[model samples]
Target: MAKTTRFATLIILMALACGCAKRSLVALVPDPDGKSGSISVSNEAGSVAISTPYRATTIESAKQQPTAPENIGKKTLDRMFAEALSIQPARPLHFLLYFENNTTLTSDSVQLLPGIMAAIKERNSTDISIIGHTDTVGSKEYNSELSSNRASTVKKLLIEQGAEADAIRTTSHGKENLLIPTGDNVNEPRNRRVEVVVR
Candidate 1:
């Protein structure tokens, strides 16, 4: 009877250990929009969801999708997947490119040039939105003019690099759409940036 009791206790302990291990490693990820969809895994893993207002069922197939490096947004999407699957989701991970300041584009910016070019190339078949903003360091009118210039500069570069002029559109927020908001006339470098959105 004592041997039987010992065996049952051991089995129970093993079962508890397995349950704890599974709970620690498993993940339940919802669809990006938190709709009626979910992915379950015994271990953490990454996934992707394309969220453009426009719909394209042909693009939904992973096999049909263009390979990475060939597609700039696709490469970023892959990075996002790797990050989401990491053991710690809270750790800083790769995100979209944000170019701040009106000075020359840096080496990092140069590296992103090709990717942007790829996106622009694809934008011919899609609608592209380019929004420009600036740090709160000048008069509203001055900042507005500066932001428009910045957006125009980017659009010019894209055009020079072979993007269709008609496919590209530009808008200036003039420090209105700040990622981080500081009081007026304060220099928040991060706010001075342009965002390119390709559908």
Candidate 2:
């Protein structure tokens, strides 16, 4: 299979594995008077179980379909959902940085560097893709070289910011994939960009 197809397949498999893994959650909030709080779980089998604080519950599926608890307050139920949402798995992030007239980073792009670096640091595992693009302002040959240089420059910056150099893969699309399609030789800043995807 082609590399793109392989990469896409790998992503789909990872998502499926995450979705299908045996997942469990435990809720252990104390009541106001130091009494025990409770949690309830119900499965598709129409069976239900209830437990006190510190007990763990196995969520059967990604939906985590749960029936109402017997004696839980609105606030406590809201808190449960809030905490559950916060603990979901991280999703892929994309960063788009535009270039100046030629090869230099635009001011906005410079400001985005810190966010990109922080994301790299925050993730436990990193797989990065950087693709450089350019406007239709020059000959195909020259634009291709320029786009490659732009990608190289971003890769260097990422490496300098403590990213593993070997983890990054870059390609140049030149003027072929314009963010804003236009006539030839137009100076479109949006088209002159480097797209970074962190997974």
Candidate 3:
């Protein structure tokens, strides 16, 4: 079998040793958006795939197989991993702003800029990413430049709204990474977009 990393983005394995060695309790949890993804736990002793939210397994020893995942209550999770969960950082926030064409933001997106700015202020966000994308309606070189311009325009607007310039970064994907994929020379409004992430 191919080797795999046993890691979790939300909550990883929580071990409460009872004067025992190589024993652990692992739990799967929902992400900030209330969605849970699958994970696999394996070793030379055994392997198991777990996908259900709030499910847990007990590994008793290196030679013994991990117990089958069973549905567990949230209260149990809180009690068992209080300190670990409390220290977890708040989830990052994401915003998508659509464009009319080229570097111009649509009317709705223009209105959205202020709200994004407000969120940045409220979070006291120091890390920000602004990525630009364009529809596949032009040469790749032209679209690349257009996307770069779009990101720059958003950076300027955010700075005007009091966002710290040093905390923000910009990148352009041109028509290479489209929100709505399309054939060459096609116009896709959804593809003309700028995505912002505040952390």
Candidate 4:
């Protein structure tokens, strides 16, 4: 049998036994949050794109062509990658803090800050992404600025709580990305928010 090794977000196969030979595999797996991601694997034979979990390509050797994509069972993966899985880093953490009509966080969202801080501090290593989003009630420029301000507000609070300033990244997606899609000029409380992902 072969074992798994981390390659970016994909899992790569490696020999795990004394007699395991040249065969190797590359599989795409979903994140712990159940969100799917994509990856591509190639060799001298050709290349294949894998976006679905469990889908993989088998490579016979460095010079030989890879086999067509196929499904690999979860049992097979667990057996092969036992050692690697044991040492993998904790999966990322996610939080969504909603805002009201303006950039100010809602009362409920403000209450979530302490829990968020605790999660970040519990990690051995942490990298944070704060993405701001706003409702489609204003001009594109205005909405963009509002989103950015939302993200900055969250970042400022995290920093004040002792989170490393350099470890946090902020982005604004204005009306482009929305939690609740609505027609123009709609006021959606859920659409106005900041999403923080800690990994």
Query: Model 4 over residues 1-199: C-alpha lDDT tens digits?
Result: 1332243123332343334475777777778878888887777667778888876787767877666666765666777679998999887889999998886889999999988899888884358999999989989999999999999999999989889988999999999998988999999899999999988
lDDT of 1 by residue, 17-67 (tens): 665332121122334455534322211232334333211111212333321
Model 3 Cα lDDT, one tens digit per residue, 1-199: 0111132211234342255665677889898888899988877789888998877777878788887787665666777789999898777889999988767899999999888988898889999999999999989999999999999999999999899999999999999998876899998999999999998
Q: How does each model score on TM-score?
A: 0.50, 0.56, 0.84, 0.69
Candidate 2 residue lDDT tens string, 149-176: 9999999998988889888999999899
Could you tell me the lDDT of residue 63 within candidate 2? 60
Ranking by TM-score: 3, 4, 2, 1
Q: Looking at candidate 4, what is the lDDT of residue 168?
A: 92
Clash pairs for candidate 3? none
The alpha-carbon lDDT assigned to residue 95 of candidate 1 equals: 17
Question: Which pairs of residues clash in candidate 4, taking residues 3 or more apart in a chain or in different chains?
Answer: 45-65
Model 2 pairs whose backbones collide: none
Residue 138 C-alpha lDDT in model 2: 91
Q: Rank the candidates by lDDT, best first.
A: 3, 4, 2, 1
- Model 1: number of backbone collisions: 0
Per-candidate Cα lDDT values, in order, are 0.55, 0.75, 0.84, 0.82
